[model samples]
Target: MAVFRESNAAPYLQPVPPVVGDAKVGGAAPHELSIGEIIRRERRLSQEQIEQILQYQREKGVRFGEAAVALGLASQQDVLFALSQQFNYFYAPDAKRGYSNELVAATQPFSHQAESFRAIRTQLMMRVFSQDDVRRAIAIVSPDSGDGKTFFAANLAVVLSQLGGRTLVVDADLRGPRLHELFGIESSSGLSGILSGRAETSVIKQVPDLPSLYVLPVGVTPPNPVELVERPAFALLMRELLSKFDHVVVDTPAAVYGADATVIAARCGAALVLARQGRSKVSRLQDLVATLNNSPAKLAGVILNEY
Candidate 1:
């Protein structure tokens, strides 16, 4: 596919012209950026710092997004969104609202968690910070819940919101939907609420700070979550979401429990499987990876939770 360089890109987001290795397009991949490496790349991410970087890149004609992609933080293509359709991760509550600074506070230390999160958020600011399409993914898994899927999801969504991506966290997990709990919102009225045609759109809660990350908390538990997940209505919802927001992220159940994870994966552009530090089973996740290979959605990869 022909890669369309961002028309207004400050030149810094483009690939360095000539690269080495499968993950490169310009000079020898700028050396795999480690956690420490990236933090150094950014002197600071404040508006002034960002402006200075953008100004310097604009003057030098550097491609910031490409640079980030070369490091595996950004995709050269709209692969994230395209993959979502290719796999069928088409379930969603709605397009998230506008992003806010408050969201960032909710999800502190995002850089300390997933290295990808740090870089992606930075690159997203290059072209589309205040839009949902920019940051539309949230990886939610449990090291038995207390380990913090909802915490992470809520925070991740918040991060995206701060970075100008209208985000949303869907309680697709009928088993234990607790995003509302994390945000101190109402849980009795979300996906299930709208799916079963019980409540109006008003039922959906607007998470604070994360006003950009809307919350369609898990509605009434269904008898057959698998069936609900497979319904055409669910698929349509996802497409509609893409049209409405800059980004939409759903908080799904674990891979071990039900088909919900697979269903959620099918609708999103990609998937991030999270496992806890000690409680999570390596062998089981390996099996889960194998399971994702056969799933309708594409497996972005696993996120081994260190904390």
Candidate 2:
């Protein structure tokens, strides 16, 4: 006989913790050198310094870079640059550089991180575009904030556009909009403006140097983001974007907070969930997936963002 246990917990009202797992979005080629070796070869640390860091790493069970930083042998920035080189990911030393420098895919196409995004793009092409029945708009969502949904959407758009596909990344996360900052554009007019009937055009700004890529920021924060998202205008806006652009990527707020992600995903008919490694929790991710499964959008496979 099966024993039954009483359930007394309330539903999770807050944004759920992200689910962490192996990186599934991009497939990276194998590298011959390790991080420590790369750092040594880059001259960030001498042979003797490497020996000291290794001794510390074994004793403390910490990473080589961590040991180096602790010993005051290398700056955090130097370690990061070396790691980027080791993993073939992009790293810009200067923060004041323009938008191109800010975009990893644009600045370092050869980097493994950029290649992973390209792999995701290929997967999406087959998942979302291979079928002739669905619309082109794809919504990207996360279990909680700071999971890198905006970063994924922006870089994915850039990579997709690089292939000559006309792509548009929409900042649908009205509560904490960031596409404007990512693309280095003004947010004076965007989705909020369009929904409020304040802006006539959905094309807020075109990404410089990438004629095929465009960005639609959250123009002005609205008091009721869920209400705005549920409006007919939002659907109309999506349709218009799909008709005009070859690929439309919409960035939504965290699934744990409000119903905005559900509304947007339902309207778009397709969605991709992102979760960062180490930070996301398994239980929370399962709950978020259950909620998403109830929506109209076809759930694309989960992406484990390792960066």
Candidate 3:
């Protein structure tokens, strides 16, 4: 596999010349790049090396990747990375890219846990994202802290962004903000600042690696967290975000904190309740569902966080 360089290096594929027949020079378009071209560009293979691999591939009667591996020119990981690029599927095969490991959808995109997130994304797309009855934004609420609400929201946003749409994850949990840390973005100005009229559109940060994903941190964590979320500005902000982004994932404080989660869910117009396998109590989950049901927000569904 290629070495992981600077965290801020542009990860997207650049345009190159078209491939010429058996030469395998390059692809007609950036996305249409053949496997050989992709591997050559990614691994910086010389023209002579490319010819060697091509000769070996023809003699072995195997695919370019298999032939490269057989010749010890590229590893299986390198082939996988090139394939991801060909399909425009984004993920960091190396940890030094600087995102938190909690973002399994970006770090371990092929893992079972990340696949589960994709499954959830598919369900949400059908139920909430496709329907006109609900807004594009969905707030993530859990019965208690440590129920993996933030983790779920972050990873779900990553998977949603992988669909080639603009997706934004909002850190609405002003009381104990963590999305900025998880995403490794600046938290100096975010929802709290926007709600307070102290900041504007600049607070929204575009996440690296994942081109279509963005994050709105909690910013200054104002003294009155509840007041900030309860204000009319918060609802307006959500509407604006929904208009701009294809999908929005809001992360709220735990239900144990107060009415913040409920209020955020209402503002977002949809809520997905998360409960841990052993930690979340049945009564609290019931109560949270009941509260969300009373509000205008549609209940997307409840998920048990066993991971």
Q: Return the top candidate by lDDT.
A: 3
Top candidate by TM-score: 3
Ranking by lDDT: 3, 2, 1
Candidate closer to the true structure by TM-score (higher is better), 1 or 3: 3
Q: How many pairs collide in each candidate, listed in order? A: 30, 4, 1
Cα RMSD for predicted model 1: 16.4
Model 3 TM-score on a 0 to 1 scale: 0.85
Model with the higher lDDT, candidate 1 or 2 = 2
TM-score of 1: 0.56
What value does the lDDT take at residue 133 in candidate 3? 56
Put down candidate 3 lDDT per residue, 163-265, tens digits, no spaces. 8777889999988889988888888877776777766447778787676788888889888988888888787777777767888999999999899999999
Displacement of residue 227 (Cα, Å) in model 1 is 1.9
Candidate 2 lDDT by residue in tens digits, 160-204: 876665677889998999888876787777777777666654335
lDDT of each structure?
A: 0.50, 0.72, 0.80
Worst lDDT run of 10 residues, candidate 1, spans 1-10
Rank the models by TM-score, top first: 3, 2, 1
Stretches off by above 4 angstroms in model 1 are: 1-147
lDDT of 1 by residue, 1-307 (tens): 0111101112111112211122221232223433223332322335554455456557667665434344444343322322322232211211242322223334333234434455544543453434344333433543244554555566556556544444566677777776666566766556765555554545446554233456767767777776766666666666656555555667777766777777766766455566777777778767766766676554544555455
